[model samples]
Target chain A: MNAAPGVVAVALVTLATLLIGTWGLRFSRTTSDFFVASRTVRPTLNASAIGGEYLSAASFLGVAGLVLAFGADMLWYPVGWTAGYLALLVLVAAPLRRSGAYTLPDFAEARLGSRGVRAVCSLMVVAVGWLYLLPQFQGAGITLRSTTGAPTWVGPVIVGAVVLANVTSGGMRSITFVQAFQYWLKLTALLVPAVVLLSVWAGDGQPHPVGGDGWSMPLAAGGGQGLYLTYSLIVATFLGTMGLPHVVVRFYTNPDGRAARRTTLVVLALLGLFYLLPPVYGALGRVYAPELAASGRSDALVLELPRIMVDGLAGEVLTGLVTAGAFAAFLSTSSGLSIAVAGVLGQDLIGRVPAGRRLGGVAAFRLGAVLAVIVPCTVALAAPNLGVARAVGLAFAMAASTFCPLLVLGIWWRRLTGPGAVAGMLAGGVCCSVAIGWTLLTPDPSGWADTLMAQPAAWTVPLALVAMIGVSLLTPARVPGGAGRFLARLHAPETLDLDRG
Target chain B: MNTPDPGNPRERVRVTGPPRRRTPSAVRPPIDTETRLGGMYLRSLLREQLRLAAGVLLALAVLVGSLPLVFHLAPGLSSAQVLGLPLPWLLLGVLVYPLLLGLGWVFVRRAERNERDFADLVRGADR
Candidate 1:
């Protein structure tokens, strides 16, 4: 197996990412630019950047793998993933932008006027970011081992290093361009190969995917457990998109409420277009490479299918293209997650410490970025077997449980006090985290516990919402006096000349 | 009644000094009052925005929440062929994305329109 093509593709992507990052760095002069691109990013560009960052290894490789293995049920992942933006568009996008907060914690503190709520939000952001980043690193490892025959650890180290370099040096300004460019690169990588492979499949006679009745049937297994899992997945992905630390952070780049809404709209189209290609790969994989599914390496279906379907040089070239896309997937997502985590850690932990006070804002952010990338890289190396899509789902479940309620209530409900926010977040965080831990530790479980633990969003989300509303209702007087003004600012258009200041 | 005392001078001559009009400055809006009015204005704006958000969410809930029931109730639909692909694959894999994009487009347009209306209201109130 010649590794030259894989190596060259990976190197080219890394170099391009660095070059773009450096180019964007010229525009990042102020702290504000480092954080939110000075809140001046237009809708189209921001949407492209969001799409770039949002479609991680999970979307690129994991979805196709899951689809190939589980069939129609796995389609929920992409559907819910795209529809999550609809939820965001409807619920949080504009007001969250209008709130004028740089980060999730900033929104929390601004809305509730409580340091405790801010701290909880900061913790959740970091938790979600790390959980999401873990999969990217793991997927990278898998991609490298399969593509270049490199050791699994080399991929993570390389990804972590490149992401850290980009994030720490240039921050959001640089990331925006790199990610926007990555969206196109990834789209092309997947699209061109898909077109070629589909033509090949047509030319070779349209053979059907080798599977039984269960493959095409939705909710055909586990009786009620299957139904429960489906809805839980729906709950997670639909609500979870708004809560993702990286995704929500991008909304802050929009110039105003309207721009934020427009950006989300464009992101929906961009994501919708991108998602169409992955399932094509999945369906094609089912036809051409059923053995990969049986061998439990279905995650490599996208990378392997072009080669299996095509012949000789064309196949290798297609493989190289897909390898580049996968590499870009890991780099772009890891960088976005790293930036989100680093921002939180820099502001909440490092920058606030007396020792770190000597370090300037950039230095603190750089230090935070290093810590952010390292923890997940270590975890990916330690626990390498978690399915990429499944891990990403857990991250979504956790977000839906915690930040979803926080954002919704904080924006809409005036009675949301600091204590309520804290209580709700803790309840959701603890429940979801425990379920994730149980799933990780137990390996294979039987009956209801397995279903419930595997997909906890359905219950945990409502619990968090109930807890927040309940606690807030019980302690009405604790509601921040500034809540009214903040809500007003969030809802009012930018053109309004109210004394928000 | 006891004695209209001459020393009292008939209640200090009942001085009539041009009815002592209040200064216009004293009647001007106070800082607290203006803020109170601004708060009211903000509350109305927020109410309108919340209504818009709630309406959109309700529509989405109905659209997406029924998917499971539809598939479960009509199991045959999933296996049915559509354009040489399984119905579930056609619907979830292909058609669902465009639907999502369409929903997003409608929501963004409406939400922005809501904001525009809100801005108009605020501007009108300011005047």
Candidate 2:
């Protein structure tokens, strides 16, 4: 494949992202602005930003690839992802905003009033952020390799540098604009090609895609295991969205609880629209390039489909467009994740350092950003290529297990003591991490072990919730005295003139 | 002036009727009930929100959770063609997104309405 179009596209995307970030940098000065865009972002823009960051390489490339490989069951990936926001909107969004916390750790410390709980939450946030970032780096590598025949490492290095630059400079304010722009770019990149491809298919008499017997089935061949995997996937995705570190932090940008809720509603619509196009690629790929699926390069289906279906300049241009979108996806998501991780590290780790009290807020955050990106980029280089969607799913499982319990219980139950929160998080984190580690190391496992390890959310989430409730009940005296006031603040509308303080 | 002792006793008697009642204009009435921070009031609001969320979750659960069972029991349904695509293909790929959006729309509307109702109740109680 010629490298000019792809290189130009990638470079253009990088330039645009940096330019936007620098432009937004003017508005980012104060600590609040650095952390949550000064909590002044309106709903539509925030929703766009959320959609942009949320639809990562997993959504842009992974969904189509998974669908091409696994057929109908893979639909669960997108469904679970989009529906996760629904869960967020209903259960977490308003209350979390009302809680007046900037990050998950902030919420934890405020709710449980324990240094230990905050510490655990900080650690988990880092873990999940790294886990999520690993795939993005890997996906960038894959995209670059396929498009330009560059060494695999180049992609991760370039993406890491760009993300670091954007995040360290402007923080959340810059990322919000960059990500919002990316959402539209991604949608257009996919939508225009989908429309053209459909027309081409119609012109060519619309050949039917060939799918074998089990392709359309919801479950895999192993009857019981398949059921387990499906349910586990449901459990993970449905509960996990609220816990994602980057996603939860975005809600804090909303002006108030109502705007936060509104942002979520718009996000659902935006995601729903974007999701429609990927399945189109998947379905069409089944007809046009089934061999890619067999050869295990189905993840490139979205990138390669336009060229396969169209001819000459049009195909090349379309390919360039998609390459740009994919690059944007990597940059946007990596920046968001980096900002989230850096914020945590800055506040809890670097900022806490008593090194002559020299490091200021921006300096601490910049240092944290470097640490956040470097570890994941290095890991991506060392680790074997886990499919992007699968890796992200594991991250979700981890989040669902840990933060989901923390958020749900912290908001609703006044009896959630600090010790209980710590216990629950540890239990969930350990269980999910073990399963993820086992899967990553083993590569291929069979029988019940495969099903259990691959999708740990079903068991792990319940374990976390149970541990939290049980431990809280056992140590009722440990419940924070301010729990009642906190609950009232979280649940009441902003219109209510309550003494939240 | 004519009866200083009698006048002093009468003034003390007039001031003794609960200071709050004596100067109702000077003191604003306590709005604790309107604040909705009382345990019962807070509980009811939480319950209302939880109920709305649960109802939305139930709808989503029933719609999505049943797909595997349906596909398993009636394998033919998966293969059946709809809109020139397999039933599963059309449903999962195309239709599910709209359904999710609709459900989300309904949930947001109801949730906001619940909040609105709670706010109104608090304001009414204040009056």
Fnat for each model = 0.72, 0.54
Error of 2 at A404 (Å): 0.5
Assign candidate 1 its CAPRI class: acceptable
Candidate 1 lDDT tens digits, A1-501: 768778988999999999999999999998888888888898898989999999999999999999899988899998899999988988888889988888999999988989989988999999999999999999999999998899999999999999988998899999999999999999999999999999888998988877988887888876688899999999999999999999988999998888888888899899989999998998899888999999999999998888788888988988899999999999999988888899899888998887723667777788889999999999999985789999999999999999999999988888899999999999999999999999998877789988899899999999999999999898989999877767777777766554545
Which tens-of-lDDT digit does each residue in A228-289 have in candidate 2? 88889988998999999999999999999999989998998899899988888888898899
- Looking at model 2, give its docking quality level: acceptable
**Candidate number achieving the greatest DockQ relative to the actual structure:** 1
Task: Compose the digit string of candidate 2's lDDT tens values, residues B41-107.
Answer: 7788889899988898899888877887787777778778887777887887778888888887887
Report the error of model 2 at residue A492, Å.
0.9
Query: After superposing candidate 1, which stretches have Cα over 4 Å from the reference?
Result: B1-44
